[model samples]
Target: MARTLHLGAFLHGVGHHSAAWRHPESAAERLGDIAFFEESARVAEKGLLDAVFFADGHSVNRTYTAGTTWFLEPITALSAMARATSHIGLVTTVSSSFWTPFHAARMLASLDHISGGRAGANIVTSMFDAEARNHGFDALPAHAERYARAAEFVEALTALWDSWGEDALLVDR
Candidate 1:
């Protein structure tokens, strides 16, 4: 028998398309509703999805090249989704350009602990001008510079994650 592939919902506001708001099922009006996101994650869990993925960026893409839609901070949203559903993996993005390795390491570790080791971080180095401006930088960090920092950031996170041995959490006092 052929193996069946597992599916994970890469959720975006209401839906993937920027114009999904015009559709009847799209809940564009409830962008800030935690219940809306929780319910959607539950529905996906009910479908036995392998995971739910949330995209992250430092700043909103407000250029309007595509229709405007709400974008929530990924790590925070994914942490909430973790509480809403069990067994479905939670993946979120963090930009290397805007955050330090220590910050990423601590948060990801907390998420992993909270979610029972099911947390995954989608590391990125933001390159958009708007994002740079948001971080008080005059220009977007150069691609090579961003990548170099990202490499170090990931390395530091990995080291921090490994620094704690599997048995480090033993409570045998």
Candidate 2:
């Protein structure tokens, strides 16, 4: 028997389509509202989905459609979703181009622990000039350069994660 692949919904600012917010099916008004996300997770849970993934951006860009503009931080939003659902995994985007290794590791690990191993961090190399400016850089790095930095970033993150081995947590009284 072959194993089936788990389905994860990559939800963003109302829906997947760029113009989804303008559609009747979208809840554009609640893009930044915690309750909106909470309810959406609930719906996903009801469908027995494996996870809800949020694609993130570091900077605010021009919005041709009606929806959020780099608002409602992913980690914080996932933490809130963690409180609302139990079984569904909460996946958040973490930029290797911007965040330090230690911060990424700690934040993801903390979210994982909070949600009982149901947290996942989607690694990304920021490719937008706006994102670069947001991080105080004059411009976005070239693809190869970004990947080189990303390699180091991942290595550092793994080291940080390994710093806390499986048995490192001692809650014994």
Candidate 3:
């Protein structure tokens, strides 16, 4: 059997560069448009890509002076994208440091069901102080502490995901 290479597109605010929004060809004003995301995902699917990924943060990055700074929530945006494409996977960055395990598990599980198992999550311990503040932390936790919490968070999330048996959702009507 031959090995296969997987390619995933990281959709970040019109483009990846901070100045992406300033480019004449960029859809700067339509960053929040579901149609834009749907089109991008469709294009990625046309190229036979494995997945489309979105990175998310709770707080705005103050460093960017001129660029698309805000965005639709990742899972929410991906749900819409899932409806527009059939084969490509939908993945999003979910900050373990900010979201409770139950919430994360339910959201991911729902997305997984929606996409017929094409949903993926990149769980992250957020690095920004602003994100911490938004989550009610006065300062970012120490690196080790954050990782420790992340480990526990992942364990709990996995347990929650596993709690539902394979046949749990059987609709026998």
- In TM-score terms, which candidate is top? 3
Q: lDDT per residue, candidate 1, 1-173, as tens digits?
A: 99999798887766767677778876877876777888888998999988888776666786632453446776777778888988788888888999888898999888887888778878989757887898899878788999999998899989987897888777888
Q: Residues 83-167, candidate 3: write the lDDT tens digits.
A: 9999899999988788899999999999998988999999999878988888788878889988998999999999998897988
The per-residue C-alpha lDDT of model 1 at residue 25 equals: 70
TM-score winner, 2 or 3: 3
* Better model by TM-score: candidate 1 vs candidate 2: 2
lDDT comparing candidate 2 with the true structure: 0.84
Cα misplacement distance, residue 7 of candidate 2 (Å): 0.4
How well does candidate 1 score on lDDT at residue 170? 78
Ten contiguous residues with the weakest lDDT in model 1: 62-71
Residue 124, model 2: lDDT of 92
Per-residue lDDT of 113 in model 2: 85
